[model samples]
Target: MKRLIPLFALCIGLPAAAQTPQLILESLVAKAGPASAARGEQLYRAKSKAGKTADSCAACHTDNPKAVGQHVKTFKAIDPLAPVAQKDRFTDPAKVEKWFKRNCQEVLDRPCTPQEKADFTAYMISVK
Candidate 1:
């Protein structure tokens, strides 16, 4: 019974660890909407620079929920847009921020603004 008390405490702690990020990410997602997502898509597709074009979210990732990236290279494709599909991939906040910083510059010629990040996440969630 004494050993079981510690085991139960450990088990209870596990859920709190798992849920904190989910809660924060969910709060961020809740603040997003379809209109903003549409705008985000527009921002993504718009011309980024005068000399060369930048990529959009749809460029590296297939827009369809079921489709994965077909290209194989420095920018190999995957199911990038689907939230349920990529949820496990982006669970780490640091990785999420890193990709946002890199991809936003690649697509927008700058890091994503907070609105863009919110809207883009909303759009990704909408795809699934």
Candidate 2:
């Protein structure tokens, strides 16, 4: 029982964002069984249905996870998506979900499934 107190305190002491990646991944795994980094890589590079007007993740992010990206239309600079390259990349659940929703719609013309999110997250996490 004494150990539980410290564990609880540790959980409570961390910011919500600090636990965002693990919590999001856990929930995704619960729904999807497991994420596939390979599938994620494929999805990330797949062209969107929007065709000429659409932008795949790689269109902006480039093929290398460690390299910086650039927005296709806006030409705005984007930070690397890899957690290793950017420590804060997946630290905010809200931000992560927000981008997922927006990007999925923009690229896939639909919302991504929990599996897709998990796969993508797994791929990003796998990057060194």
Per-prediction TM-score: 0.59, 0.81
True-vs-predicted CA distance for residue 121, candidate 1, Å: 0.6
Name the top TM-score candidate: 2
Whole-model lDDT per candidate: 0.54, 0.78
Candidate 1: stretches off by over 4 Å:
1-35, 44-47, 50-54, 70-75
- What is the C-alpha lDDT profile of model 1 across 1-128, one tens digit per residue? 63243345356764223322333345345444323657655654555553123356555564454467543345655654455665654455455668888777766667676667766655555554
* C-alpha lDDT of residue 19 in model 2: 49
Query: What TM-score would you give candidate 1 relative to the actual structure?
Result: 0.59
Q: In model 1, which residue pairs have backbone atoms overlapping below 3 Å?
A: none
For residues 41-119, could you state the per-residue lDDT of candidate 2 as single tens digits? 9999987767344568898889998899998888899999888998888877668889999888888778899999999
- How far is 115's C-alpha from truth in model 2 (Å)? 0.6
lDDT of 2: 0.78
Number of backbone collisions per candidate, in order? 0, 0
